[model samples]
Target: MRNIRFLVVIYLICQNTLFAQNNPFYNQWEPSPKEGAFQMEDYIVWGGSVIKGEDGLYYMFASRWPKHLGMSAWVTNSEIVLAVADKPEGPFSFKKVVLPARGKQYWDGMMTHNPNIHYHDGKYILFYIGLNYEFDQPEKVGATRELYEEAWNHKRIGVAVADSPFGPWKRMDAPILQPRPGKWDGAIISNPAPVIHEDGSVLLIYKSAPVPYPARNQNRTMNFGVATASHYWGPYERKGEDNQIKLLPISSDVEDPYIWYDGSKYHMLAKCMNEAITGESGAGFLASSEDGLVWKTSENPIAYSRNITFSNGEKVNLPKLERPQVLIQNGQPSHVYFACRNPEGQIFNMVRPLRRNQ
Candidate 1:
């Protein structure tokens, strides 16, 4: 009986593995192009989103901070900038600063990070997390944990709109999403991922914590919540029980989600924080939902890995690869983007092409 039971378990595991391998999206990764990387000599480049402009140009809204201040300074010093390319995958060139530090008086005054670009109703929408603190910009020497705590807890999700990607972006004076006072999202909201419908309705998934940062312990987990807005601009309301949309079945370690719709259903790709879901922490996982609220893990959940293969047949393992954004063109995912870092703390954005189903 013991042997029979063991064999049954083994067979189930094998079946699951086979199912995972069958995923259309997971099986479509092409080697990333070396020239597709976007980096600056004196800046730390992070994640970005790309959209095809009406002028037939590709525009990427990405985050960057001074290299001297280090990556952690993203909480206090980062700004949203625009990069343009002739093709979807390029050696993109910096165009201009789209969202800079306006003033400490406003909620998103100090920093703007994790931009996700979208188009709805003939307008360009940029969603991102912004923060402000009482302290001045830290020197190259680095920021204290206390300062990080102060800046981080103020983090809120906001949006900017413009007629074109080359925009005089009208940034909101108030945040579009704020934390609940004593709920699962009591602490803060960051990492806005939205799928905009043809009618301009938005289904947004965002990261939240029960308690403020630096106060979280082993029991505290970073989770995701879903919100819907009838129109992209107005009153957004949380969905699901306590607004906690269960994107992952096993754990709350997933974050930096990128969501999109492919005509029928919603699909998401996010960083697997630990080894629970993907068995490789920091690798990305894939999930899908018939309805936006009830999400299920993909049969083969692994989306991408930190071990990168270049188009020229070279391979390198990166230390950190987070904040994934998929560029959807002609009703399919064409390229995947990421914020990658080396052991020495150098940061840059990368793009990998995907094989389209013929």
Candidate 2:
């Protein structure tokens, strides 16, 4: 019996090694460019989603808020903005603010963030998280926790439709998805990652919480769910058991997910909130789902680490690297975009090219 157990252990190790070797996304990262980053002198940038337009240009919808307002103010002051680049690996220049604070009266009036752009059925769909609160906007870095908590609970997934990327966008009066009052997603819905199908259906994944803000501080956890809509803009219905996609049986601590359907199967890459499955905090993990509802971790699950390599061969583990977005060209992933913060508090959007012909 002891020998049999030892054989089982050896089989498991061999399986892991074989899977790692066969994983397409593993070791596919090429050293990134040193200069072509999207940044602003007075703002903190995050969550960049790029799409190639019919005009033969790349358009990026990203989130940014004033630097003086502090990082926590992202819940209150962030806005969705547009940038343009000639190439996917971009030195993208800021074009304009696409979604800004209008008023607290509107559902998404206060702030817009985490833009995920898609082009489908002759229209451009911009998916994001927005929030509103009754209080006045905070001025400086140190704001009250109450103010932050209130803003956090207000987050909801929203979308804006436009004929062209250049826009006269028609934003909805109500959000596309909202929190369930007593359900697992009772607190809020944020960080939308959507894949618009060729048949005009949409499979969206978003971050959710069980309890409202401040209450969840004692046990901070997040859950991810998949919702489907027949049309791009629609009454989306949650799928799976209890409307939650439990990626890991042990922990539901993943966040900032980016999902895509690459012809055959659905793929997801998300930030590992804890070292539960990936064994490294802040690493990106890959998961696969035959259908959008049921998902399992990819064989070599560690998609990326915080450590980044430059074309010049310098490697640095970023202090903060979150919000993974992929730019797919001709049904192939060409580059991956990330929101990174260095130790000096400098925040920017970085793009790393993916090795092709895999």
Candidate 3:
């Protein structure tokens, strides 16, 4: 009877391993050179979220501004827009600009960018970055790097709540995460990567840098930081401020972290900005943490690269790909979504796969 039971346990472990394949990464990828409705001849689109709606359609929450406004506009004049698609790899149609610059009096009056949408606490919560400041050059299409650098240093993470994916988001009076006065993130904090658990705990991994020395924009000591809260929206406190959660070495940094908690641990995918994972710039890497505070790079840390090939056997090397997000469907990673750049206009999506063969 003991030997029979032992054989059954061994068989069960083998069966489960076969089903999961012992690999959670790798998948098919497709790209639309120019994306969705808002890709006007004069508009620039950047970071976003693509989620399946309860209505059986796909909704993308993204950031955009005019090409005439110049790239720097992302830090000064960008807003969160909504678009819909029938399929995950879409010719997504622009629906509306959901979060716009309210007014100078508001903290997010200048720009609202980096939208990460999640459903928790019986509502849809929009995690994003907000920048606010006073400026007089309305007629000018763009600002100088010095001007943008000043505005960007004030960026903070904010959240908006809505009953449904479609509408009526209520934002707070101020940002939820602010830069600590004398820490690594003392100058700026943005690019929110949030994972909301069933028990209502929220884990947010975001980007940050220390105070500037010679000038604000010249410093490039950007790295990842961790914060957690009992509720989806917080009162979030930074976890490793004193030691700093430096996943990579002090010489290298990671950004655009998308975190998810499997049953046993926390996992993340982020842009390997400094050749830390793949020994190349503009690559994607995967990592995990048992406790959601300290992280370890996967043995095969390089997940994908900016240069990608499709399942159709066609390939093209992209100049840039950033802001990686995984859409979880039915307790598994379904689709990999991210932003790509083109000369004609910016693409709000790269349209990738998450399965081994796609």
Candidate 4:
């Protein structure tokens, strides 16, 4: 009996070691340009997405803000910008500011952030969050608190459409999806991860909450919800109306979710708010569901961790890695992108290529 138990322990250890050796191609991001290739002069660039356009160049949609605005400026003054690179691992050149503030009347006119670019139905669709402040204060650093709160209280999901990635984008007059009055997502909807299906349908997985909404994320909790539309310019309807928000229950509050349906199942890589639920603070959760509404996290749901081992043999456990996005090139997940600050005090996006067997 003792020998049998020893053999069982040995078998488990060997299996674990073998699994650890099989790192995917995109797991280790290239640390060649230590400062990262996406930084701007007076702006701190974040929230990156890379897409191959008809021009054969990779167009990246990302968020940026003034350097003096501090890290917290993302909420109040962030704007979406476009950059072009010859390759996905880009020495990218700035193209233009894709989405900027219009005015106070439009729902997303005050600020434009969190750009998720996709080519859908023979057009380029840019989905994002916009906020407006009707308050009596100027929107600066400290004085912008009331404005920030109003923006937070009024944030909604808006979309822009264009023929080319380098667009003269035609933005819709109103948000496609808005907060429901008495539903779980009544407060706000942000952080949109949308997948346009081969059948021409759209599936958007976004973060939301109810009306007793707190301004800060760490002070409150968020859940992932699904909405479907036959057309990108839709009539999007939430999957389970009352139970729309709380898919995983309060025991496992998730955020920063990037979801895709890979034909057979829905796959998600989201941040687990509680360390006990997913191993570490920034340890990502790998979950799946056959139907989009029902989800199940993996038995050992550690997708990746903050402690990254770069391709060039540099390894550092950063403070945290936020915003997980996958660049699908040639019909497969070719690279992974995330927002992280380097040791050089520059916050920019990072990428790691995903290969079959590294």
Angstrom error of the Cα, residue 127, model 4: value is 1.0
* lDDT (tens digit, per residue) of candidate 4 on 145-187: 5555656777778889999877888888888787776666777
Residues 253-316, candidate 3, lDDT per residue (tens digit)? 6788888877888778788777767777988877777877777774556667777665555566
Predicted candidate 2 versus true structure: per-residue lDDT over 1-358, tens digit per residue: 9999999999998976676544545677899887636888899888699999998889999999998887888888899999999888888999999888989899999899999999888899999888889988777778889998999989998889999887888888888887897788989998998989999899999888889977888857788988999987888988889999867444558899999998878888888877876777888888888887777885357788888898999888888889999888887677889998866667889988888764
Candidate 3 regions with alpha-carbon error over 4 angstroms: 1-23, 27-41, 137-139, 212-214, 241-243, 246-251, 310-313, 343-348, 356-358
* True lDDT of residue 67, candidate 1: 90
1 against 4, candidate with superior lDDT: 1
List CA RMSD, all candidates: 5.1, 4.7, 5.3, 4.1
* CA lDDT of every candidate: 0.85, 0.85, 0.74, 0.73
Please identify model 1 stretches exceeding 4 Å from their true place: 1-22, 217-220
Where does candidate 2 stray beyond 4 Å? 1-22, 248-251
Q: What lDDT is reached at residue 267 by model 2?
A: 86
Model 4 worst lDDT run, 10 consecutive residues: 20-29
Best-matching candidate per TM-score: 2
TM-score of each: 0.91, 0.91, 0.86, 0.85
Model 3, C-alpha of 62: deviation from truth (Å): 0.3
Our tally of clashes for model 4 stands at 4
Tens-digit per-residue lDDT, 1-358, candidate 1: 9999999999998875565444545656788887555888888889989998889988999999999887689998999999998987777899999999998899999999999999887899999999888888786655888888788888899989999888999988898888886788988999999988999999999998888866764446788899999987857899997788766566557789998998888988889888888888788888888878878985468888888888899888888999989898887678888998765566789997887551
